[model samples]
Target: MTTAIRRRGPDADGAWVDTDRGVALGHRRLSIIDLSPGGAQPMESADGRYVIVYNGEIYNFADLRADLEAAGQAPGWRGHSDTEVLLAALSAWGLDRTLAALNGMFAFALWDRAEGRLSLARDRMGEKPLYHGWVGQGEQRTLLFASDLAALHAHPAFRPEIDPASVSQLLRFGHVPDPASVYRGVGKLAPGTRLTLSADGGEDAFVYWDTLSEYARAAGEARFRGDAIEAVDELERLLGNAVLRQSVADVPLGSFLSGGIDSSAVTALLQHNASGPVKSFSIGFSESAYDESPHARAVAAHLGTDHQELIVTPEDALAVIPDLPGIYSEPFADSSQIPTYLVARMAREQVTVALSGDAGDELFAGYNRHVHAHRSWPRLARIPRPLRRLAGRAMTAVSPARWDAAIGPLVARKAVGVGEKMHKAAGVIASRDGDALYATLISVNPDFRELLRHPSEKDGFEGRALEIVAGLPLPDRMMAMDAIHYLPGDILTKVDRAAMAVSLETRVPMLDVDVIRFAWSLPADMKLRDGVSKWPLREMLYRHVPRQLIERPKQGFGVPIHDWLRGPLREWAEGLLFDSAASLDEYFDRPAIAALWQRHLSGAGNHQHRLWPILMFQAWRARS
Candidate 1:
């Protein structure tokens, strides 16, 4: 089981078990903060009453260590590793106090000898992955947990059923949401929550922290009493502190610089806080429309950091396509996964840990939908419902190919996927409510149920975003929903899996607790003004790098999967899509799948968003 996820921790491996008590634990070490043998696990507390196997860094371990000593409750040190610090702190402070004091990404399990109990916990922001569940029935039932699903599958008794609901959700969102894994009887532990299981077959789950309640309690009650410039200054201070804490690593470190407001701001801060020059990594494309490397290079030159970039070829990206299912260890269809893995592989050559600018959009209202909601929602709402639906249908009725043929001169091909964009806009224009509107904005296929063999009564997540930010402005509500849903299920999951596949660690200082809370407290005007977005972030980047070097129309971290499927990848895609012998054939409607493929091929529409998920699932299911 430990060997199955060796890429997650190649430095070392260890296991501890008490057969007499029917308890066992395993760990694969990715030595970052501490490299000594004393830092090895599965480690036991000094009193020999507790044992733990943990993944991820505790950025505040040193602070907690100091507090322990200050109170004269510190245990004799085993090693400098945060793993040891965690065990010691948990022993001294007990569970609740220790969990509350923690400030970093982590997923871990602690075994209590005296009580014969096992406690599982994940970080507040869902950075690290932890899964736990029972596999068998009655007396033979077995409980399993791991950072990757591949590890649990290594167990002989672990037989899981396909979850149809999970498949429907994946088709809509591109990645499976929290509390549901691809398989039945297994779950991705919710971030900031814990589960305690005992030999008596008794178990309990608790939420130690929640983003919604926390945002409400802090941002609602103590809103930042500052103007836009003042908010920017406060943001700078908070992010500066976060970078300082996250920079404390024993291994070589760097940052991902896309030259956008998010990455540039993070890279700028990383260089400012570092003792010497910082390393920066980026991925490039031959296609200028999809390229951000030049911007990254300009920013790196300005920051004076050791910069590296990889100009990836179609062949380079093609070589990685076969490994996507294994790298993700599940069915995931974020086209950007291609370039993200390429960058991580390149960065791993020089740095063990790389800081990212992810979550900036969620925290500070940087997405296009946030802008649309603020600027267009009122106008959209003024139209009668039936007329809006009629207009939307009229837009989609004209196939993308026809739209491009008719208006291609107006909207250039450089904007690639222009017709697809129009189709998506049609969906947004026709939404019935704010919740449905945001759902349509984020989803790949708003009508996903039509393709399912057994459609769900409804996908619970569509309305979930509205519930999270019930009374906030549309822009604030949209961003807040993404901070909870999209940020974790897709963006963070993609980065974590892609980086860990190469034994590299990635951190997000923008997701730092202080930064998140502060962003939420600021008024919507500070995050979005007039029609512009991420106002404070732009100001911060300008202070370190020139405005021209940083400012540009936003571009996604994406690959040309739509083009590939019609070109070099077409043969491979066909084998999976039409391979009647495949497992996905049993779940997805064949006629529907074939029609979508034909439409994409004929340029009637850009169906990559819808097809990619099905292809991913088929590829993953083949091996599973």
Candidate 2:
């Protein structure tokens, strides 16, 4: 199992087993913080009761160590590694307390030999991945866990059985949510959760921390009472501390600079704190509309950092498609995964660790959906339900192309393709309520039921939708919903897998617990103000770089998948859809799939979003 995931930690590997206790632990080391052999894992404690095989870095380990020393709890450490401090802290303060004090990304397994118990835990925001489950039955049952699905596949006792419900989730959201894996029986451990198994085969799983609960607590108690300037200053201070903590590492480190609010903000802080110029990396495209390298270059020049940029052609991006299935190990249809992988690869060439400006969108109201919900939902809700339905139907009566042509001259041009935006807007108008409306807006395949051969047995969102902040405005609700769902499930997963594929560790300072709490405490207007999203974040960026260099329509990190499907990838897509149309019938409606592919090829409409998920699923299925 450990060998299967050598890509994640190519530096070193180790394993420990206790035959009498019927237990074993394994680790593949990346050797980021401490380079000596003393930093190796499955690391054991001084008293020899606890042993752990951990993944990820502890950014605040130095401060934690200082606190322990001042309190006279520090053991004569063998080396200066976060792993050693973590073990000592676990011994000193116990599991729950140690987890609460941690402010870094991690997923680990700790075994208590004296108590004959094994515990598994993930970080507060699901930045690192962990999967666990029991195999066999009764007396023969065995529990298995790993950092990635490929490792689980390597276990001799593991069985691979597709979970239809997970497939439904992939089609619905473009990625499966937590507590469910692509395979039956096995499950991805939820973020901020811990699972402990006893010698008797009994188990317990509980949340050590939760983003929803934190948001609720902050909403009820930690509401930001300061004015705009105070809020921005406080935000900058929190962000600076977060970045400084993450910047601690033994090896070379840098930040991904996309010139967007999030990445640019992280880069600015990193450079501000670094004694030398911070190393920065970005990936660009020859395709003008899809490129953001110019902005990134301007930011790097202003920040006076050592910057690296790679301009990839369509062929360079297309070359990554064949490896996506294995790299992700599940059906993830986020097209941005391509650019993320390319950028990660570029960073890997110069640095061992990189900080990203992820979670800023989720923390603050940065998604277009949040704005759409805020601007359109109130007006739509005022209309009677029947009248709204009539309007929605009328909007759909005219094809998206006709709507675009009719409104093109009257309204200003949008960043998104007019036809695609109009079609999506129709879906929003057709929603029945907030939950349905948010789901429609986020869904890549809203009519997944029509595409599948059988009804999904598992309810979407696990029988209930998110209602973290019940009484908040529509925008806040949407932002909170995404924080709990989309941010960790899709965005974090994509970055984690893509970066780890090349043995590079990516950290998100924006998701620091303090940052999350503070962002949620502010009123919705503070986040999205005067028709601009991520207002406070922009304020911070403007402090470091001029607004003109960064201000523009938000161009998401994306590849030109729509153009590729019609041009370079048409043959490959057709073979997967048409050549195997009958074979795919067991899972999909062949005729429906064929029609969608034909329409996309004929340019009737841009069906890339819908088709991408199906293609990803098929690609993964073939590899599995």
Which candidate has the highest lDDT of all? 1
lDDT of 1 by residue, 1-624 (tens): 999999999999999999888778999988898788888989999878899999998988899899988999888887788888888888887887888889999999999998999999999889999988788778778789999998998988898787888889889989888978999989999988989998898998888887777766655787888787888898899998888889888899999988888988889999997778899999999878889999999999999999999998889999999899999977998989999999999999999999999988998889889888888887998899899999999998988888877777786446777777888889889888777788789888788887889876657464554665687777777777786778888999999999999999999999888898898898887788767789888888788999989767888988888889999999999999897678556889888988999999987888999999999998888877
lDDT agreement with native, every candidate = 0.87, 0.87
Could you tell me how far off, in angstroms, the CA of residue 529 lies in candidate 2 after the best superposition? 2.0
What is the RMSD of candidate 1? 1.4
Q: After superposition, how far is residue 412 of candidate 1 from its true place, in Å?
A: 6.1
Residue clash pairs of candidate 2? none
Query: Which pairs of residues have clashing backbones in candidate 1?
Result: none
**C-alpha TM-score for every candidate:** 0.98, 0.97
Model 2 misplaced stretches (Cα beyond 4 Å):
404-416, 457-459, 462-468
lDDT comparing candidate 1 with the true structure: 0.87
Per the 3 Å backbone cut-off, how many clashing residue pairs does candidate 2 have? 0
Q: What local lDDT score does residue 77 receive in model 2, on the 0 to 100 scale?
A: 89
Off by over 4 Å in 1: 462-465
Worst 10 residues of 1 by lDDT: 457-466
